[model samples]
Target chain A: MSVPLLAPGDRVLVKDDWPEFRGPAHIRTPHYLRGKPGRVVRVLGGFANPEDLAFARPAPKRVLYHVVFERPPLWHEGEAGDDVLVEIFEHWLQPVPAERQAA
Target chain B: MSTPARPESLARLDRLVAALIAKGIVTESDLVEAQARTDRASPEVGARMVARAWLDPDWRRLLLGNGAEAAEHMGVSMAGAPPLGVLEDTATLHHLVVCTLCSCYPRAVLGYPPSWYKSFEYRSRAVRDPRGVLAEWGTTLAAGCRVRVVDSTADYRWMVLPMRPAGTEGWSEDQLAALVTRDVLVGVALPRLPVALAAE
Candidate 1:
């Protein structure tokens, strides 16, 4: 209902506890990127929250963010520094701390 | 695209089409036109744009910035389709397109969705481990290069404008386009040089 907290290019930490936080409910956030640190590549406007839409419930406009993660850090094995991208809902992300964001 | 789909699904589609026709919501001609439209939407359309972008700098800029406008200039029809997005691959940046939620593609420019693209394995992993997926397709980017994976959806559809390979100097647009396969358009593989294809 208010303005979105984060904008494009802000570093975000995806919350692992989503869609009931116990086991799993219908969700838009991918499983692998849970609790991972990544950077927002773009603010992809807003859409009906899929987290609620899955249950056929009314979903208000929610900001969508395109987040990018480096492969090696995100995964245990892979070439380092190659970026992986995903579109995640606003509720699924948290702003990283100021010091870590600066680094 | 020719891989056999389930017969029950095909029969269900036929029944749906029949219902539409009976209700006058659609006619046989409408189905025919839709079929023709999809048939015209092929990799060659994407390849043609890539070929022209290869030759013309301004055109490439226009193609990258606004794909629908560039497509109109090239006489490719994009009416009633979603906005187009062409992710340009450069020496430093590489791009891959996938619909992690569903199989959303630039079907107006790249024809029918490939079977592999719609597979659960690809939809599940492409966004999570793109470099590993690229490695599966024999594409390995350098350490410093950034691999951006774009998710195509209902609002925007994307295709890749792959970088031109070396050893093709003075080649005609057709020659360069000949090397641009559907996989290159999807960003799973690179356009092969003539020498590379010749060796195969």
Candidate 2:
């Protein structure tokens, strides 16, 4: 699948999907960050799909993104202004819906 | 240092290695060479890079702009490893690194990840309560300084270029590198002027 690359400053939302792979699927996204809103911090370029590498299959390259999230929204006790940056693959990210973005 | 592998786990690994060797998938020499390379990997490699960046502005730009290339320039072979990302800590911002899914680290530069780094407790708390985790490690940042936690969740491995400690104005690169420990590189602790020097 050809996933469009996201640029810095673009707001994106992480997908909240769970893999039902029987064995190890090598999904790198942490469960907590799933479905969270974040801003693209950097375009990290492409890397071999780890999911395919884990199963020793022919892995296609996928674009990776460095996305930054605010701490307060992630945790109740999280201090304001603190940020969390997560490296996410293009396939797992979606454009933030208009209504979902905070004004 | 990580905990020693349990005997059963070790035995299982041995069986796996034996099976691979029997299938001609891997040779004993390949395993030996890989072990040797891992043993040679150390935090000093990262410290040296930090020190050089402190002493040289151009070097710092290179390190931050392209960490893997910078490492290769410094004679650290990054063959077969994913790209390296250096997180710069500034006066108003501090950077911390963690791998939530597994123990993915900048092994080429900082050697193996510490046992605590791979613990479930750290992985959970780092994202949930980073300030609390830093406090436990005795690294208290300024009240207004934002702590940016960088999760090395995907293909990129990250290391912190900790802010240079005060009171070391005329120090050499070697001297500066000495102050940067593994904890400081990982952002669990901040580099500090030694107590004696601070008192002076």
Candidate 3:
């Protein structure tokens, strides 16, 4: 299998950017990090997305991006020790600072 | 072999036999022979392996480094099955195994997986909150042991060989194997038996 290309320090947003998928997937996203800001710290790897794999469709390659955020930044007035790091697919990410180009 | 069994029941039996054949546990040439052997064997082989590993350092290292090969030396072949990696528990690390998608097990090495190991409840909740699941299994870890939950996907399977208990200094391999249970091998149970308890 070909490795999906992704790198650390890349910024991302949810592909669907839905509130539900964000908060519920705790291993990737904590409830405090939902609707909060974060940045990619590690690029884990890539595989066929589970959604596509389940449907038996030929899924385009997707990279798994791990994001990091301070606990206080994610939660409004939350504790300091609750730092959050999450792994999400490449398609879910887009360039941060809107004007900066994603390469 | 025509009995008035219901179609569904017959289909279930066929599937069971097919699974057994695929695993090489049974063959057409010795169908009756295989059935008799399985009937005589305990359903807790996997558990026994776990317990034995916990008590033996050499065996634990062998299991963790090359599970299939080590199992083969013990007359178990983890062939035609997904690659299984056995994880050993230490003072700093603890391991838990779960099949996130489907129930894939190292049958040749550990024997049949328990019903709870393949349950939807265990599978779905394991990755989300492993400590909760471990708590249900009656295991409460000491401080500082990072719990690593391994997902057994289609490509890989995992078993946890826990650390040996403190009280058994002079025990035979057969005595050790008897303490190993299927749940312990699958990462759901811990091995805790004194020599006195083992003797009993």
Candidate 4:
């Protein structure tokens, strides 16, 4: 899968349906931030997005996005190095500032 | 550093083993022998290899790219296991390995992974906050290096071949391996040579 090229320092948000592991569950995309915010640091990999497979839907032809987050900013009281970057499919993402549309 | 396993899970494992034995899938004696064999393996071999490689750049590269192959070069077979990958730790990036699904390890090279490496606490927390996880194991990284925790599921298992310490001019492989501890190879600890220790 070819992910749209994401440069360093590009602002992006965690896709709503990104699988919530122990980190994402407690820190980045908690219930409060279900529709909240984030930014992209680096592109991690190109592979089948977990959201599509988990939902048992047709594979949406999109690349996975990996974004990083600081712990304090994400969870307020989250510990140091709680900086997390999650990978999500394009279908699950929407523009955050209401101006930028997800590519 | 042992994480508590659920009683139900333990019971399930016991039941599974019993069933395996009853069905003749695995003999009780065979299971006992496997356990004893594993217990007899030591981490010293891996540590020694790491130390020797640290002093030798060519060997270090081989170790990182193909751990099993590198093991064979050092007289370690790494036989009876799947292929293994070795992650090299630099000043800016540290590596930690965990078996998220099960304790898949490179027994031939590094010996058995510490019990904590297979625990729920290590598996769940390491990916989330690897620095905190390492700190618990009595390892602290330099300020600049970012920690990258890797998962070793059934598909791929990892070992961290740490960077060699500075100031050892002509150290033998044996001397170097002595400095390579099990924790260092597992990515929980850093390699510290006598010179580096003195400087610190």
**Highest lDDT model number:** 2
Decide which is better by lDDT, 3 or 4.
4
**Candidates 1 onward: DockQ, in order:** 0.36, 0.86, 0.09, 0.09
- For residues B61-163, write the lDDT of model 2, one tens digit per residue: 9999999999999788998888999999999999988888888889999998888999999987887788899999988998789999988898889999988
TM-score of chain A of each: 0.86, 0.86, 0.61, 0.53
Q: Candidate 3, which CAPRI tier?
A: incorrect
Per-residue lDDT of B1-200 in model 4, one digit per residue for the tens? 66689999999999999999889899888988988877766788678667766777888778766777887776765676666667777788777776554566778776777777778777677655677778787887778777665555322356777877765557787767777888888888887767656676
Compared with the true structure, what per-residue lDDT tens digits does model 2 show for residues A7-48?
A: 888889899887845655678888888888899988888888
lDDT of each: 0.80, 0.89, 0.61, 0.64
lDDT (Cα, tens digit) per residue for candidate 3, span B1-200: 22478999999999998999999988876978756544543425555556556566787777766776766666654556555567767877676777765676666555556677778888777655667787898987767666665555433456677776666668766666666666667666677685567576
Poorest lDDT segment (10 consecutive residues) of candidate 3 chain A: A24-33
lDDT of 4 by residue, A58-91 (tens): 6445554545555555455534553543444444
Better model by TM-score: candidate 1 vs candidate 3: 1
Instruction: Give me the runs in candidate 4 sitting further than 4 Å from their true place.
Output: A1-103, B1-24, B74-80, B100-104, B194-200
Badly placed stretches (over 4 Å) of model 3 are: A1-103, B1-59, B194-200
Candidate 1 per-residue lDDT, tens place, B47-136, comes to: 989988999999899998889888778677778776677888988888888887678888877889888999988987887677779989
